[model samples]
Structures are given as structure tokens and as C-alpha cells.
Target: MVVDSRSRTRASIVESAAKLLREQGADAVTTRAVAQAAGMQAPTIYRFFEDKEALLDAVAEHVFATYVSSKTLAEDSGDPVADLRAGWDAHIDFGLTNAALFGLLIDPARGGGSPAAAAGLAVLQARVRRVAAIGRLRVPERRAVELIHAAGTGAVLTLLATPPQQRDPGLSAAMYDAVLRAILTDAPALPTGDATAAAVAFRAVAPQLTGLSDAERSLLAEWLDRAAGAV
Candidate 1:
């Protein structure tokens, strides 16, 4: 792939900002500092990014991609719950090790606009879908995804806010177990499984079903919701 000069410059700027974040924390990633680190003038950064926040967004994206690339999840492990556990562990580790970047990505002001944050959510949704496919999810897939995300993010932020020596080492694990207890079935979905769990699993993959009109799908979704609530 031929890397153009403009792309190279943008890449250098993002790299510089990422380095600043990783080494000096979030407060140190000023536009001037990033420009100097990248061996470019301050105005050059403006030409690439609208503002410092934009630059930080790019830096978060670059760092996230680099991290995810190094620890790419397997496409499938034949056990969706196990895959979910692996992903939870990786997410906690990533947040702890990249506090500055993680904070930037998880800031409520950014909502779901950050590319890195969206990518992380997509991964969670995919993992949840896998569990739904096997009929083990006890909650709607979206609900399960949201719960896991909230729990994982909250756990990391809480731990980060505490002094290292005072932090409970079991906090993250306990949170994960709590989330699992709320969202998963004791056994895989079977022909004679809990109706609520099975309904929730079916709801997760409902959109992928074929030969259904929009109205039919909507009606089916309502029925699934009612069924899932029976638990």
C-alpha cells in the first residue's frame, strides 16, 4: 500500500498524541506538545484535526486499533459464554493499562460518537449474539450488552479512581460474575430450556430471520418481549 504524504502526516500526528497519552497522561496531550513531538508546527495539526478534542479522538482510535490488533479475539471458540468471559478480562486489562486512553474513550460527553468506543460496543454485541445463537442468554442481547458494558466500564473507572494499594483485586471478577448471573442461563438453551431465556435468545437473533414482513417481525418481537418477561 502506497502511503501518501498527507496520510503519513496525519498518522505521525496521531502517533505523537498517542505517545503523549500513554507516557504523560491525558492532561499532557496538548496540541503544541503533540506538534512538537511529531516534528511539525502547531498549525499543521489544525490542518489535520479541527481541535485538540478531535486530535485526542484520533489518538484514542489509533491506540485502540493497535491494542485490539495485538490481542485479536478468535472468530469463534465454540463456546460463546467462554468467549464473553475472555472478552471481559481483556476489556478490564485494557482499561487498567491504558487509563488515559480509556478515560477519553468512555467519557459520557462523547456518548457513542468515538470510533473506538463504537468498535468496542460492536465487539460486545457480536459476542452477545454468539451466546444468543446457542440459546444461553437470559436477557435480550441489547440489554445484556448494555449491562456488561456498564459493569465493565464502571468497574474499571472505580478501580482507577482508588489508590492502587487500596483497590480490591477481586472487584472486576466479582462484577463480571454479577453480570453473568443476571444475563446468562445455567445451561445452554435446549429444546426444554427456560421459556424466558429461550425467548430472549430468540429475540436477539430475530432480525436475522428470513421471510417475515416488517409487521410480522414487529409482532414477533412483541411476543418475544412478553415471553422473556415471564421470568
Candidate 2:
């Protein structure tokens, strides 16, 4: 089937805007610049997005959509640390690779400045809740979620801001060691790579507990792909 030009134009404009935000700062994504980047007129861009704020929200949404890529996440159900290692790896990988998306996500001047920012953040926080519910977080689940979120976000932000040469390897496990470890006190009886290790330490079910539709999982996988190997 032939694609619709208007829909194609709209996607192109949002993509261009996201590109500009990533390449520059969020302040740089004017409709005119996006239109220019899209090879369309400014009014043509306006026809799709209501205004710059709307465009920015779209950009933010797109950024999130990019982070949760598929590929099945190869989850470890045994050791909490193993599950965490996988998640932390995935999380930071997304953050560092999509610096532009990361910028829009963490930067207060961009989507963070908008009223809708809380909604976007809540979407991510909810994901952490899923992980916390896994058996490893024996302490209050809420605090475990908080610690994990703080650690994951902090690590990603630090990685994004820090020069590659200076990033800390120890920082990678900081949240799990400092926070979750307080609850899951036992030194692992199993090895990190053992197939049963992650499961032994964690709940049988996976952490992304939205009962996500296959479509959602597929979208998330694509986003993870953008994060590439940076994490």
C-alpha cells in the first residue's frame, strides 16, 4: 500500500525535531528548523504539531519509545544481581547511546520543563516498580524502587555527562550493592552466569510486569537497540 504523505511528513518532522534536540539542546528545535530539516515549509510542520511544546512532548515520547527496545532482554530470573546487572546494563546503555534522548529526558530545559513531564517520568518509574516487586527487594518495595531509580538515573546521567575516559566501572553496580544488597544479604550461592542464579535470587516472573502486549515489547526492543552497546 502507498504510504500517506501527510503521515510521513508528520513523522519526519518529529524525527527531525528529535535529531535537532539530540544534536543541539532542546531549545534549538524550532518548528522552522525542523521544517527546514524535513525539507518542508514551516506551516507544513505546524499542520502536524500544534506548537513547539507539542512537538517537544512528541520528541520526549519518541525518546522513551527508543529506550525500551525488544530482543527479549534475555532476562535472568535467578539472582537479583544478575537481573539487576542486565537491567542496569540495558538502562545505561540506552542513556549513553541516545544522548539526545537522554538530554531530552533528563534536561530540565526541555521536556522536563513541561507540565506533561511528570506523566512521562511516571511511565519510567512504573517500570522500576515492576523490578522492585521481584523477590530480591526484601525491604520495603517502595524504597527499593526509589533506590534503583535513583541509581539507574544517576548512573545514566553521570555517564552521559562524564567523559568516557573517566567513567567508573564500580559505579555500574552501586545501586544494587548499596540499596538492594541491604535486603538480599546473602552472598550468592550461585555464580553470575549460572542459568539459575538470577531466578534463585529473584521472583519467577520477569520485572517488566505490565503484562506488556507483544507490540509494546517489540517497540521497547527497538529502543534498546538504539541504546546499542553503550551501557
Residues 1-231 of candidate 2 have per-residue lDDT tens digits of 246877777788888998898788777899779989999789987777789878878887766655543313355465445555566677777777777666666666553454344443454444443443343334433444566667778878877678989988678667556755654534334335432224322332333546888787656544433332112
Write the residue-wise lDDT of candidate 1 on 26-129 in tens digits: 89999889989999899999988999888888888888977665445556678888889999999999999999999888777856676656676788898888
Candidate 1 residue 107 C-alpha distance from true site, Å: 1.5
Q: Residue 142 in model 1: shift from native, Å?
A: 2.2
Worst 10 residues of 1 by lDDT: 67-76
* Candidate 2 total steric clashes: 21
Q: Number of backbone collisions per candidate, in order?
A: 0, 21
Cα deviation of 17, candidate 2, in Å: 1.8
TM-score of 1: 0.87
Local distance difference test values of all predictions, in order: 0.85, 0.61
Candidate 1's C-alpha runs over 4 A off are: 1-3, 65-73, 191-193
